[model samples]
Target: MQYQAPVDDMMFLVKDVFSLTERLGDIADFADFDEDLYAAILEEAGKFATGVLQPINRSGDEEGCQYNDGVVTTPKGFKEAYQAYVEGGWQSITADPNYGGQGLPKALHVLIEEMFYSANTSFCLYGSLTGGATQLLQAHADEATKQKYLPNLISGQWSGSMCLTEAHAGSDLGLLKTKAEPNDDGSYSLEGSKIFITGGEHDMAENIIHLVLARLPDAPAGPKGISLFLVPKFMVNDDGSLGERNGIECGSIEHKMGIKASSTCVMNMDDAKGWLIGPPHQGLRCMFTMMNLERLSIGIQGIGLGEMAFQQADAYARDRLQGRANDGEAPAALIKHGDVQRMLNTMESFNKAGRALGVWLGSYLDETFHSKDQSKVKTADIMSAWLTPIAKAYFTDAGYETCTIGQQVFGGHGYVREWGMEQHVRDCRIAQIYEGTNGIQALDLIGRKLIGSKGEYLKVFLSEVNSDLVTMPDSAHKNQVSELLTELEQLSETIISRSASNSEIPQLVACDYLHYVALVTYSYLWLKMEVAAQGKLDQQSAFFFKRILTRTLGLKASIESEL
Candidate 1:
């Protein structure tokens, strides 16, 4: 199945829904970017996603990656595609201009990422990790490390990876046993094995820079003792030339159910040369910065996957003839059937909601990055933190469901590999499992986000929602939005109170709480989009906006049932 970039829909969100131009104008960091230039960039990105990278999606999945003696090679054509990606300047879209990045607002980057993910998620993982690594270095690493590494990484001459999980430890980073012993020359010898390290060892770039977490000698126990390190595959000279091979090596690669095109390797750091990122014993605190961005990125991936699946299924239903409709007409394409239309409509509504939410979250991140006012930055950060897990779990869970629905639309053909629907199902499954399991994500939402800090986060979040409700003019739809807000407040109260009384209550009710939060958030965005579409409701726009409102109502009904 071929992937097509949703350029028109994305442009609608960028220009109409979120007002990207206005937001960028307000940010001092992005003051240099005008809409025309941004559009040109986005156009190029869309072309790359549609015309270049997307065509190779199935081939990559089929060929997978090859692992040899301490070397991992990507699928055929990936190297050339990656070269085109580098030349197009995508790796640096969110990086700093001081280090040769385009320095575009990350909101734009998020939109581009969605298209890239839809086109080829497995290939994009390597670039995603590299960008995350760059963000870490720019934020915390010393001037020397930043100057030496940032340019190459930003330019895509080198790729990056995150090494956090071990066989014994996944979410519980405090249990990690990777040891980093200090050396005489202000370096550390990293000795440990890290598992599930994506792009840990790949031939896609000149050097692989690893942002790993390990425990330093003489440090306290648990997460407090852990620290971040930069362990490159090949050490570089002061002038950025390759110097010597680092001690880190890929022990082996994982054979996974999905994303086989991307190598998930076990990295054995046998006295690997390393430098600490930020303060000692504050690894978890610092790692959370990258992980938080990653969580939301993965969420966008889920939505993108779902959108891709929906597009394919919708096309197939239009082309494939099936049984007659209820009107007793002769057999027509399945899309002519009312029930099939209903399924497609649901998928479309879910996809739009997910996209709008992802864009909103990305705008929040841009605000967090560019806002000079500490209070504004804090507000955006809190809201982003509160919504990150929801975005991750909800979008991905919905993606998996959408993929299954797409398969169901295909009937028995979906179960077989010939239709390619099975691949979508398989690829969408890992989004929920990796990047922290969906169950754990839900627990984090209710347990940590809602009840954490004695409900301060949830309280502040509800205040913002109420503030929006007040500003919205009174209308029937407005009243409906207000009612949803009221229910959300009540739900929050019940969850927080119940969770306080019983430690297990949050876990028991996590799924319900996650659904409630997701529905409420999506409803808010759907309303905004509806209002935006009111004056300019062409057939396409009207159909899309109405379908979203319909889904919002359905999700609202679901939330009430849980109550």
Candidate 2:
């Protein structure tokens, strides 16, 4: 199936539903961007996604990446496509202008990102990590370090990767054994091996700047003692030219279940000369800056793949002739079947609402980063922290489900490689696993964001929801969502209270609570979209209210039962 960017729906969410332009107009950084500019940027991005990226997706997957000694080679056309991406200035969209970046709003960048992921997830992964790493360095790296690295990274001449995981440690960062010894010249020599490092040793860029987490010789134990370092693939001369290769080498690449085109490597660092990113024993804190951004991007991965899957399924359902309908004498297309319609509606509802939710979160990210008002920045920061896990876990969870439903729409054909639905399923699966597993995200939502804050995050979220509810005209959908919100508030209090006595309660109910919150969140977005559409998306809205929103009832029941 062909991949087309949902530029129209994205535009609707950005302009009509979210009103991002007016919201961000007060910020000096975003004053130049209007609806027209957003559309033009998205249009060109859509073309690149559809034309350059999508074409090589299947071939790239089929060819996969080739590993030879310490070097890893991407599949055919991958290099050219990456070069085109860099030349198009796609990498600079949301970076700082001083470092050769476009300095666009994250609200706008999110939409373009969705298009890239939707077009070709594997192809897009190589660049997505770079974006995350760029943000991390911007927020945490020192001035001199930024001057030496930020420009090349932002311009896409070089790419970046986050090196955190090891063979023994996954989500538990404290268990990591990567060692960093201080040198006489003030630099650190990192000696550790990182596994499952995406774009770790790819041939796409001139240099790969690795943000590695390791321990100092005299550092304390556990996560607190961890520190972040910037380890480049090749040593750079003072004139900004590439010099000798660094001590880091790709021991081997993982033969992954999916995203075969993107290199997932096991990097062995042997006395790799590095510079610390943030303060000592504060690596995890600094890394969260990058991890949080990557979580959002990973959430988009789910949205993008689901969009692609839905398009393929919807197109196939409309064209493929099958059994007869009750009213029709002739054999009807699969779309005529009630069951097929149900599946398609489910996929469409999630995809559209998921996109809207992503943009909604993007708005908060914009405020957190660019807003001058401290109050707005603080609230945005809280909201972003609370919602990041949901965005990562729920979007990907829903995305995986949507892909499966899309595959089911094709019946047996979806299982094969010819239709491309199965590939989407495989590709999207990793989003949930990596960037911290969905389970880990659920734990974070329940433990740190909700309970740790003494329900402050939840209160902030509900306040925002209630404020929006006041503006929406009276309707059953609105009332239902409001009722759900009230129930969620009560449920949250109960969970918090119970957690004080029984620590196991939160862990047991975290996943369900996440789903419950996500369902309600999607319902709220759907309600807003219904109002914003002025009857344009009535059918889709009705489907969400009638069929999709009902899932929350069971999720709530599960949570209550657990409590």
Candidate 3:
């Protein structure tokens, strides 16, 4: 299936629904950018995604990556594709200008990322990790570390990996056993093995910088004692020249169910020379800077694949002949079937709302970083934190479902690899498992963000929802969303109150509570899109209101039953 970037839909959200350009204009850094520039960027990004990335996706998947001795070779055309990506200056879109970056608004960057992901998710993973690493180093790395590493990282001359998971320790960082002993020269020697490390040992860049989590010798136990390190594949001299090889080596690469082209390496760091990123014994705090960004990017992976699935399904439905419609004598296309239309509509609603929610979160991220107002920065930070897990968990869950539905549309054809539908289903499956399982995301939402904040974050979210609600005209769609919001607000209070008496209440109901929140949030976004469309998207909006928004009712019931 040919992947096309939905540039028009994206423009509508940025220019109309979200008004991203106008909102970011208040920030001096993004004030000069206009809708025209955003359009041009999306157009060019779409070209790269279609012409360069999409063609290689199937071939890459079939060939996969090869690991021989200590070297990991990416699938054919990956190196050249990555080079074109770097040469086009795509890597520096939202990086710090001080570090050889373009310093563009992240709101715009999110849209471009969606296109890349839709075109080729495995290919996009290589660059996405680097983006997250640069963000982390920019936030926590010291002046010397920043100057030494940021330029190459931001410019895509080098890549990065997040080495957090060990064989025994997956979600629980407190159980990590990697050790980091300080050297006499102010560097540290890291000795440990990390598994499921994406882009850990790729040949796409000149160097691979690993942001690893390890415990210091003199520190206490568990997560708190863990520290972040910048361990490079090769050492650098005083004049920024490459020196002797470091001790880090790729033990092997995983033959994964999907994203096979993206090397998932098992890295062994034997006395690897490294520099500390932030203050000692505060690694998790520092690593969250990268992990949170990665979580959001992973969410976009869902939206991208969902879009691809929908396009393929839609095209197939139009071409594939099936039973006659109603009383027709001759056979008709599958698109004539009501059930197929429902499936297609479901995918469309999820993709559209997921994309909008992603861009909404992206605007907040841009504000968090670029807004000069301290008050705005704090609020944006709170809002982004509250929405991150929702975007990650809900988007992936919905994306996976959308892919399956798309596969169903193809029937037996989907089961076979000939149609490429099954590949999407397999590729999207990992999004939920990695980046903190959706269940873990739910726990973080209910346990940490909601209850931990004493419901302060919930109030911030509802305040914006209510503000938007009042401005919207009174209609059935508006009324349904408003009613759902009220239910959500009341349900949240019930959960908070009940949690005072029971500690396990959060975990018991976390998943359902998250789904409830996501449904309501999507309903709200659909209303905004309805208003923004001015009748253009009326049919899609109606389908969402009548079909998709009703899922919240069962979710509310499940949460109440748990209580």
lDDT of each: 0.83, 0.92, 0.93
* Candidate 1 whole-model C-alpha lDDT, 0 to 1: 0.83
TM-score of 3: 0.99
From the highest TM-score down, the ranking of the candidates is 2, 3, 1
**Candidate 2 clashes between residue pairs 3 or more apart in a chain or in different chains:** none
Which ten-residue region of model 2 has the weakest summed lDDT?
322-331
Q: Which regions of candidate 3 are displaced past 4 Å?
A: 327-329
lDDT of 1 by residue, 253-338 (tens): 98988888999999999989999999998877887778877888888788878888899899999999888877776678888998
* Minimal lDDT window, size 10, model 1: 536-545
Please give, for residues 468-555, the per-residue lDDT of candidate 2 as tens digits.
8999999999999999999989999999999999999988999999999999999999999999999988888999999988888898
**Candidate 1 segments exceeding 4 Å error:** 471-473, 535-563
